[model samples]
Target chain A: MRFLHTADWHLGRLFHARSLLEDQAHVLDQFVALVRDVRPDAVLIAGDVYDRAVPPPEAVALLDDVLARIVVDAGVPVVMIAGNHDSAHRLGFGARLMAAQGLHVAGRTGPQASCVTLHDAHGEVRIYALPYAEPAAVRDALGLDLPSHEAALQAQLAAIRATHPPGVRAVAVAHAFVVGGAVSESERPLSVGGSGAVAAEVFAGFDFVALGHLHRPQTIGERVHYSGSLLKYSLSEAEHMKSVSLVEIDGAGQVTIEPIALQPLRNLRVLQGELATLLAQGMDDARRDDYIYAVLSDTGALLDPMARLRQVYPNALAMERTVLARSGQASAAGRQLRELDTGTLFANFFREVADADLDGDQRRTLDDLLADMAAAERESA
Target chain B: MRFLHTADWHLGRLFHARSLLEDQAHVLDQFVALVRDVRPDAVLIAGDVYDRAVPPPEAVALLDDVLARIVVDAGVPVVMIAGNHDSAHRLGFGARLMAAQGLHVAGRTGPQASCVTLHDAHGEVRIYALPYAEPAAVRDALGLDLPSHEAALQAQLAAIRATHPPGVRAVAVAHAFVVGGAVSESERPLSVGGSGAVAAEVFAGFDFVALGHLHRPQTIGERVHYSGSLLKYSLSEAEHMKSVSLVEIDGAGQVTIEPIALQPLRNLRVLQGELATLLAQGMDDARRDDYIYAVLSDTGALLDPMARLRQVYPNALAMERTVLARSGQASAAGRQLRELDTGTLFANFFREVADADLDGDQRRTLDDLLADMAAAERESA
Candidate 1:
């Protein structure tokens, strides 16, 4: 069966205070067009449909209009779930009612297990709708202290496996920060400490694993894939190509993944040049249609980069100047400071900048920094 | 043509920290069911689809599901616009593309003006989408230096009248605070000073004016009506019967407005009683299906009423104590204090609260309060 597998739409969200609605809408239009052209049997919006638990009205309307066009007008069924960015209670509001209309919404982690089985001409395809889960929630739901996201997910998968008929094709949709996966600077930190990392091997038995949360489309193994966000939500994600994935599963449970292109509303380009050079060249072409982040390399003094860039890119989000390196070698005092342990360096910097007092214990800790830095350097080298 | 007129959806919004998605979705479900049962020709979402310019993702998905079911699945066209709560530029993102699928969206007040002529069995109905026109934007759009919202709106209506064919039924949709219409406490004050109140007669020529912004379903005139918000966004609007207005216009320009019932996910109730009384009453029935606000009227102080209310109605949005009487009554000292001029009262209050020193001029101003109060009282009664 042919189906479109996409995740991390994060609709109605913004990059800082700037609205990403237009960019999001443009990508959604492409997704809708893809559904029409590709004629996929179903569209799996894996998770993270919204950026917050509570979205604004326009965001709601925009999503409503787009989804209506895709599902009802274009004749495709949509299977969606709540992500960490979403409030499960809010998303699950009318799941039972909407499910009757062929739109499957799974916003909650089931106590036992949650899976939606779709029967097509080829065979029975069981979709495990696993919304973003915290370790405590997973443990409580499964009636066991699973310890980690990987272990909890495995437990849930085990429940699904026990219930599933033998030899049926299965796919799991999830939103998590997995171990050994590349993380973009734009993606939010999932958790603190060692608990954040979920082992990618958790989905070993599934035919395919559609992931969300991480905004860069990539694969962990042969079967697990992230569709990424519909648009680059942050300047940090400017280099990543945003797209949805289309997966085809045969009767044998083998899956093939295809990436569909998305038309970006604005081309996020970073221009690195000296202030004078950028001003002389002007931003005539960039001004026409795009959001630009300009970095001006001015060595000697500070300049009003924003004032200059606005003349070219009126919607320039941010601007910064690159500090030039000192021509001569550092002074003995500066070299001593650099060579000091990180703790000593941090203490010295903080004391110099803030003119604050340090306790005897703190000063003693700073003295031990050289040993720590040496150990770290030795390990890395 | 029969259409359901609704506005101020404020999707992905919160009443403080409480998510209103469930309440919003419930009302939208009722709206969808109404459309399915009543079979309206179109749905008019006047404006303010989101509470803020940037909404969370789940709100987007919820709206998407509702619109899909009503418009795309039920074969009903939707006409919507942006309100003051929205960022016009963001809302208008995919308007052009969505227009192809019969969803009309207008976010800005443009020079060309936005008028969509919908063809029906009766005849062509010219629907002019005015969006939320600020005085400044309207003045700029019409090339007038000193245009008020009333004048600008009148000019726009005149332009529409001049352009559209004679005898064609016309209905106008807008998002503005009109004079003599009751404003819900939840609605943000549109304009400072006298600017917010646009005269109702500005919409004189249209057969029907589907209005938004105020989250109360009411009429300014015989033909101009507000559909109100989908749910009570604030405790102040608890008594409001949230609804959608279904309007039917004939070829002869005769208009009929019908109220469509909205089923709130939870009823908003305000309880005025002592803490003990409220608790002893056992709010289990109300707590089970209502978002409540409790006003404690305890003569003697009690420990946190909020904590107590949460023990019963966990979804209580707000709780306040009614220490002061509803009437404007006070003790002799209180009356004397109230008689003080605002400036003097402010200085004295600040002196007492902040323990700050006051000058001789501040003391003299306090003496003038009694004289001003006596004169005002004599003039009044």
Candidate 2:
């Protein structure tokens, strides 16, 4: 049986504070076209169907349209789970009815008494769909107060394993931060302070495991894979390529996996150079249309850098003055903030933020505030 | 053909700035029960399914659950339209697929493109469901620049009339104000200035007209009716008898209209008395649970009247100091703000808001402001 594996669509993601709905929609259209060609028996979306627990109305509408096109138009069965970013209740609302239409959404769900079965020439393949559940939720469900993310996921997998069928291939769909997987900056830490990672060996008996919660696609074992997110959700992901994984299982229960690349409408690019050179001749016209994250090397004065860059690169979403950033960092390496004089601190803060020094009148206001503080301190003492 | 007609559910409505979700859920549960008992051939909701165009997730979930219960479980076909409050495209997503499951949602629909047909003992009953269209939308759809709300409604009616079927009973579901319908303060004006009332004569061709956008249950003709909102939406609708319209159309082209009352879980109420009296024994314990809008008659100052009233009426949502209100209104009738001194003006404003005059310190501050103003004006001159 052939099935597609993907996760972390993050449909309503706001990249650098701008809505990525159009970009997402464009890529999803391509995905639909691909699905038509591939004609897989089923598509497994591991999790993170929405970027937030309560997505915007347009996001909901977009998801609705895409689901209809996939399940109704393409006539392919889909099984999805909820990620940490999704409201399980919202995602799980029409699960039972959608299952009839070949779209099964499993979320806010417990360890199923039995795994869902799909058939091919191999006879049957058992699939266990586990949504991202908090450690508290897992504890409540199993009557065990697990201490960490790994414990919770292991417990969930163990429960499913207890019901695991013998002598047939099994696949587990999960959203977790497993140990030894590469990390991206945009991923929210599932647990506070400590690591939220589970060991890769937890899925020992399963033939294949589909994963989410990391936006970088990589494999930890022959059978375990992270499909990653659809688009560049963060600038840290600017250099990483994105793809969906395909899993083909044989009649003898053997599995072969492949990662299929997606052609994004606009690639995410991080460009670095002096401001004038970057805009005038150094940058390629072909890459100019990409979503640009620019770093300027100029140490001297620059005026309205973001506004000026926008004139040439309309999609330049973020900007950084490397000279100012490094200088500010150097200046702050020695002293505590409260120990510094208010005037110097204020000037440093203004320069760090606005990349400019205070004018004469603004300096006078700061001086007046310092004088008032001196007077109040003297009186209190 | 028998059907239940209701409108202006305004399901996520906030009454006196408090969420009425529970109240709405209670009434809708009763409504589902009614549909089951009545076994109506279909249910017609004219418009305003949600209080806002983008309802909160819980409201969307509530609507989803209710629709599933009615259409999937109870097996009744539902035809609903978009009102002025809803974003048509968002509400109309997946409408075609839903229609296959006996739920017909009509919105962002062109003028008179087609009609939904429901079967009965007769050949069929053609239901023309027209969503609320703005003058601009109507003008664009009909390719004519209309002048007023009446013109827009007339144009839409004309388009629907152009497709009117003969010899079968026809019902038109609309969301608009007709001429001579009783005005309620809480009903949002469909257009600016004058009235957005289209004449009742617009429905001349249709056998029956089910209308919404008027919070009052009233009739303009023998076959035309306003089911009103399922719950009292505004204080102005405190005395309105809310109900769902029951329409039974005979195979012989005859029609019978009945208005069935809906019992709200907690009724909206306005209560008047002195603050202490309201808290102690003025209001009955049975009525205390109602969402109360309190009007305090005490001429004396009262501390946290809303807080005190809430001790008895946990749902006390609003308060008005009648004595201070009328006195302040009477005091300001013939006065000009620039003609009065700062002290007197500040005193009057304070009394109007807090039902008390300024204390010595506050009065001194007002006198100092007046002195500073006089000095500034003199220096300018």
Candidate 3:
């Protein structure tokens, strides 16, 4: 049985306060094209279908369009689950009714209702959908005293195992922070204020475990893997090669997985260099449209560098002064104090406090204030 | 063919800054029960399924549950359309896919696609869902130069009639404000800066015209009827008797309409009396839980009457001083000016400007300021 295993679409996610709806739409268009070409037995979306519990209308429209294109037009069956970020009750709205139309969404976890059986040339393969739930919810659902994610997962797996018929191959889909998995800055903590990781060993019995909640694509155990988020949601995930997993299980229950990369409309990139060189390079850079976080190494005070940089790289979302960090030492500070003028010092201070460079009007106001103060000092003397 | 016709649900509406989600749910639960008991061939939600285009998650969940119950659980089909308040693009998502599931939603108006045919003992009843659209959209869709709502509806009817098979009964489900229909404050004007009303004659040739947009349930023409909003969305609609229409069409295309009144969890009411008498009556009133808009007739100075009224009428939402309006006349104004104290004058001014009466602390501060002013006057004298 072959299926496309993907998760963490995070539709309607904002990067550095900039909306990624258009970016997400661009990649999903490619995803639909892939589904049309690949024509897998089913498409399994593990979890985190939306970035928030109540996604924007555009996000809802995008999901609806993409799902319609895949399930209705392409005739591919899709199985999805709700992640920690999703409101289970809201997402699960038409799960039962839409199931007949080949769109299976498990917004809330249940022992019997979570399992969806699909048949390929091999035979019936049960896909157990374990939506993200709090420990308290899990405890209530299972009537178990599971206090941690590990225990909750274990209890869930036990329920699935008890319901499974012997010799039937099964695939487990989950959205949890598994042990030893790399964390990303964009991921919301599963628990409010406690450890929320589940052991990789908890998922050992399943033939293939497809996971979500981490933005980096990696395997936690031999058969368990995270397909990761569709796009790099954080600057920390700049190096992540975002992709979905194509899983194929043989008639004997053997599994093989392949990572299929998705090309984004704009790549998330972190650029580090001197301000002048970066600006010069940005003028001719092919990836100038990429979402950029600039780290400037210039030691001298700069005036409205972001405004200047945006002229070349309009998508530059953030910036930091590497020189400021390196100049934290007393010697560097003393040298800088000796070299810089009052206006520059005030500008720097203003930028540090307000997170913005002074505009032309503000600069003139400051100059007038300083002149008035100096004149008063001279008169008093 | 028998069907349950309803419109202007306005789900997730807020009345007097108070959320009516629970109230909406209560009525919809009754709506679902009615559908189950009626066992109609189809449940026709003419338009305005949601109060807004981008509804809250709870609203989405509510709509989902209601549709699931009616279509999936009760084994009935539902035909819904987008109203002026809805985001057509968002509401239309997964329309084609969900059509197979018996939940037909026409969010955008189109020539051929808007028509949904359902069979009954009588014959095929083609439902032409003309979702709320401006003149421009109607013109664009029909390739006509319709400049007004009347012209737009005529053009749409022409298109639907052109393709519709002769001798078949057709129902036009629209969300347009028909001329001669009673207007209410809660109904949003269909157009931004133009006359948005369409003549009832534009719906000619249809067996029955199920309409929405007006919050008052009334008949516009011989066969055209509005079911009104599910609940009173504005104080102006306090007298509206909200209900849904049960339509029965015979083999000869003759129609019979019955209005089934829906009992709201809390009725919207406007009360007028002296503040003391109103509060005293509210203590013995069985329907004190009703949403009350109080019009106080007391001529004397009162302190936070609304706060005091809530002790008996917990759902009292708004208050108006009718005495102030009566006192607008010259004689009454002279009497009020002569009788009112300085504190009362200031309090009235504060309430008029700030939309809130001064709290105890504020009143104390005002008194202290007045005392200080008096002391300064004495010192000057």
Measured by DockQ, the strongest candidate is 3
Q: Which ten residues in a row have the lowest lDDT in candidate 2 chain A?
A: A372-381
lDDT-best of 2 and 3: 3
Among the numbered candidates, top TM-score falls to 3
lDDT of 2 by residue, A92-184 (tens): 765544565777788675645225688887688888888887676678778898877788878887887776768878888889998999877
Sort the predicted structures by lDDT, highest score first: 3, 2, 1
> Cα miss at A278, model 3 (Å)?
5.6
Model 2: per-residue Cα lDDT over B301-340, one tens digit each: 7877778788888877787777866878632343244334
Give lDDT tens digits, candidate 1, residues A17-60: 78888888887888888889998877888777887666655675
Please tell me which predicted candidate would have the highest lDDT against the true structure: 3
Instruction: Give the share of true interchain contacts found in each model.
Output: 0.00, 0.18, 0.56
Candidate 1 local Cα displacement, residue B134, angstroms:
3.2
Model 1: residue B191 alpha-carbon error in angstroms: 2.5
TM-score of chain B in each prediction: 0.83, 0.83, 0.84
Q: Is candidate 1 or candidate 2 better by TM-score?
A: 2
Determine the backbone clash count of candidate 1. 11
Which whole-number lDDT from 0 to 100 does residue B11 have in model 1?
92
DockQ for every model comes to 0.05, 0.15, 0.27
Write candidate 3's Cα lDDT for B1-381 as tens digits. Answer: 888888888877887789899999999999999999999988888788888766766787788889999988999998888887777766776677778889888876675547778887777999878888766667777788986788888888887888889999999888888888888777766643234777888877899988888889888767898888888987768888888889999988898989899898999898999998998888889898999988888888999898999888899998878777766665446534644545667888999999999998998788667545533432221
